[model samples]
Target: MILSGTYGELRSNHFHSGLDIKTQQREGLPVYASADGHVSRINVQHYGYGKALYLLHPNGYTTVYAHLQNFAGEIQKHVKETQYKQETFEIELFPEAALLPVKKGELIGYSGNTGSSGGPHLHFEIRDSSQRPMNPMLFGMDVPDKKTPIVSSVFAYPLGADAHINQSQKLTKLRLIKQMDGTYKTEDVISYGKIGIGVSAYDQLDGAYNKNGVYSINTALNNTPKFEVKFDKFSFSETRYLNRYTDYGYYKTNRSKIQKLFRESNNPLSIITNEDDNGFIHVQDSLDYSYTISVKDYKGNDQTVIIPIKGTKSEILNPRAIEETEDFIYSDHATSLTKGKFSVYIPANSIYEDIYLNIKADGDTLIFHEDVVPIHKNITISADISNYLEEDKDKLFLGRLNYKGKPYYTKTSRKGNKLIAYVRLFGDYAVVSDTVEPVIKPMNFSEGKWISSQKELKIKITDELSGISSYRATINGKFILMEYNYKNDVLTYDFGDAINTETENNLKLIVIDNVGNSATFEAKFFRK
Candidate 1:
């Protein structure tokens, strides 16, 4: 049976596409097949769903196994052979129809924290034959769940000029009070001209206390549906628009996940199940109205909240107002700053909204939003480049330093007007590279030889810059594939092929980095 550890949440940018399976405390737990299927796809990436496998079952469903520790016997052999031939660490392969078949209850792989996973667990997913992800708990996974969801936060938004929250013309958080029973009630009555709501909440399974995202959310006004969204499935193409579905500034600053209790103008999360009267409810003059919101998981467990809004048409106490300025030019292609430390030049017709910029000078560092445009504009930092570099002034490049410890190249040049930086906005950083070599560590068997029946090999690779690019392996001097899963930075090789009825075999492994640095390991082993 398919089990649910967490339900998907309809998030901004993209839908929470699958259920996360708790792996009982740690990694390396055996994962079983849900139905008869063939291994259709295998992907080993540096980030985001590392060491993932896709199986196509007979019932027009495709199951995904992500953050895997290692594949099973025959499957491991096939993966290793390809890795050796390609001589690379990251790979994506679509196998033939009959390449690797599986039976229900059969072992497919081991669960681990890989890719973009934040902790140790199995990131399981169910998709249609078309590869669109669906909520796995819909398949009747037997996970016990009795605890109701906790409504940790609520946000009310003023969508239009006349809208208000309580009595103010700004976004406000409603205080919640839990009565003797488990149900939650609002502490204050809300009054507004016109407004919408947003919520930030999660669910929990019985066996595992880990908090998981909720599966669906629905809202109604006076028992008439206003909006609804389900997290059952979504396409990756819509993932980035998450900003449209959330309070971006709130998430960027506070790190809280707040699903805009109400849809905004032109927001694009397609999972929205209901949209009525522009998703804004009017609080009629001197009238009382009822609002209800329901949150649920994939197994049908649910929680409902009732809100009574006593309407009073009132003037705004302090109106939120922004003064329009003509000194700084705003256009679809670029934002010209007359008073900031940086000026951004975007390609024509690229900006979606009038950007509220926060630009400043911070001692040799020039920073700006990287996603507003698609052109090469430079941030002329006050620092003198002659202090940090050799005579090749024209060849000096600018780069965005990433948290992954890799510096990505950006097209930049220094001229009299300013330092021109050609970049795509959002998450760009200034970075430089180093010539240091990467470090590799083999956990068990030494560099020479060993005698044992161990079926797995484990190694760790680390680099200061540009990170580990790829890795390869060989058995008895013959090529073997070593899948490098960057999430855990572990290189794994199965002994299915290197083993024979009789005694001894030699194994060699090599790992390489983006800067062409390399490391090698050789050993001898015996398998009975």
Candidate 2:
């Protein structure tokens, strides 16, 4: 039961949905059913958990296994038949209650590095009756642990407009020192007004020094509990709220997440079960206040940090300047913006708080914001493309330039004269056109090739711009299963099921890019 990832670990815009059991950097390890259960759901996709199965138990709990290399014979045949019948690579199935019953320790599948998995591991999970994921460690799954959770860094934050930490409005990064008693302490930070704390820390297990997520975080002021964040269980719908749970803006600039001790108004994560006034402490007078934060792992090994903050009314010496902008959008209501040829619609509750929008229009490009504030949902942008030629209208779509200056396609839908795109990120947007079709290069075979000895076929599909949207391949006009590895722009097909029984076989493949531009490939080969 080696762990590669812990349950409830913080990830990019989502929590680690399950515990990743390490398979020793290899795949095809036999996976057994955790308990007596019936298969409830099965999913196959090109990304995310890839090949996954869900088993619902009699005890009202659901166990999940993901990133599988192959399932048991019956399940594999069932899935293959379904994929052929549907003529698609990805499918989700929900069977009847008694359709696929199994006992404990039954071989269900084999682990593999599939979909978005970084390596070969079994991503496992335990969920309640309502499909909410609970920490699998709490279910008596044992992995050795002896090391205490590490508290490496901390930060002090001013909660409100008038709040100041060390006479500055900007956040103050605090340094911690390990005491003789094995506890951590931060030097006093003179602050006034409402203030909160944040920590950049992680836990390590015994025998393995890999850093993992903490189990619990308790923040207190003056020895009174302000809030307690326990990652015992969480719902899937609230998982994306992890971006709001931490300092998202800081994370964008800095790679690591700083878990805020306090909660944001718009964050709806269910991890924090108890809280007092959003875990904020108000200090008005010149006095010393005790701030304590205790972090622990699931094994009960804990680390504590105590910082004494002096509530002094200090004057700001080096205040961070707030950007002056003409655009102001309140978060409570829907906002519509029109600047020259571009229009934007910010849905209500899309932003965490009211923010001054620094927007500008430079010719065809629209600068929405600097990607600083947190956005909860998609913001729609409409760009007028009527000026484009009628032949190029289909190619004119919206693109958002990333920090690296590469423009990625935003999901764009065409209206009467506008290209409407729904973007979840804020950055420079423009009406870009992608007229070039995707490029497909056969890696292992050529036209009129006799490749009876080959076990599989491989092809490289590259789209220099906008990227690939969809791809399909058929042998003798029958759909063939082609596994796409997006990281390498390669698609591979095993040559057993969809091969033609006849001597000669005709293969046809079509690849499409984001802006509807597509390329096709046709080849003839001999199977035997």
Candidate 3:
């Protein structure tokens, strides 16, 4: 089946990894297998693609069904067996190719909203043999869509120092109006020294009420196709840069994502189709310029917006003439200070852009709404812990400094500008560590003893800092695969050809932390 969502666009950690299927705003919809295959992988996470299943088809392709409520009868049994055997709430299991087979059109799962999903829907995708995700719409899943996308907002930004918008070095959101002919026109023409354009738009299917992200956007100057970017595919490796792709402050405060149709030099998304030295369009003396942006979706529905600019060079305003004087006051209970980390504090009326901010202390975290530039001030959390924790506090490690159960490493150190936390209006700024080792404890076997004859080895692992990075297993010194379930912190290895009838076997597990720290454990076991 073809996917309903497009690729690219900034997403969490990674791009939208797969197609998010709309289940008609409800859960428990029957999900059919796209092709004949074996149940290769099943994952249940608390936040992402909750209760997802992977089918490895014969055509060298794999189809993923995510946000599922339940699996089919046999598949449910298999999941229960593993869950009961391992005793955990979340799991990632890779069964042998022959263990669970499926046919095309067979019922595999029921759709629901499980993970980080906002509501009820199924996130689907198709990947090649090597597990690289591809657009599922290429396979012919039919989603009838003819409506063009809607442009909700338009913003113009001043890029560098001395740059100005209409002779004023400040970012502005332009007012746009829709004409009776289904076209958009700006209310006031823009004159800028050097700046870029950002757009906020979304797509919707013909019969569904859900607002979805667009698939492609192209900007042209004088019909020359200056920039073209298609949201076809992106890796999770570059998803956090979504901040750079949009008006960060606007999104932080306004709750909107403005897709940057123009490329900034420092931006890292690989989907930029056009580039220009000066992203701003400079209209000469009494010159009129035409700008057009075309948007499309997976089904080829299109929308075009035309913006006409009447540029007239004018003198810039004096910086002091328009400067608004403001004072920032911090309340006694408003700031939480942490040592040896980055901290930010925003004084009232100090920010012009919308920002997402986290303010917390003593394990209580609160997310504030986007603040306008004149109403909020940023504050950094820097505490002088040398006088508080002393030199010996480094060895008395803090455990699970919880901000909603997400742990952050806290060290008492005197470093340059030791601000550990900052309150900004937009973007996620949570503290995580790459220098700490993960906690791995054997659940089924002690440090020196034979495990039960259950034909499997299981262990529980956790990381209070950056979480578990990677792990490797060896049975009698041969490499074996261990599936990691981030939710339950459990790792399991199924008994296979690598382990045969023997009086004793040396099962070794070596787990690497996110920051590259390693921990090893060995135990003796026997299998018939």
**Candidate with best TM-score:** 2
Superposition error at 246 for model 1 (Å): 2.2
Local error of candidate 3 at residue 223 (angstroms): 1.5
TM-score, one value per model: 0.77, 0.96, 0.62
Which is better, 2 or 3, measured by lDDT?
A: 2
Question: What TM-score does candidate 1 reach?
Answer: 0.77
After superposing candidate 1 on the true structure, give the runs of residues whose Cα lies further than 4 Å from its correct spot. 1-5, 10-14, 26-28, 313-315, 321-352, 359-364, 369-428, 431-433, 440-460, 471-528
Which tens-of-lDDT digit does each residue in 129-163 have in candidate 3? Answer: 76877666667767777778878888776654554
For model 1, residues 126-221, the per-residue Cα lDDT tens digits are: 988677777666776677777777788877776667777677877688877666765666755557677777788888777665667777788888
For residue 484, model 1's alpha carbon misses the true position, in angstroms, by 3.9
Best by lDDT: 2
Please give the ranking of all candidate structures by TM-score, highest first, separated by commas: 2, 1, 3
Cα shift from native, residue 438, model 1 (Å) = 3.1
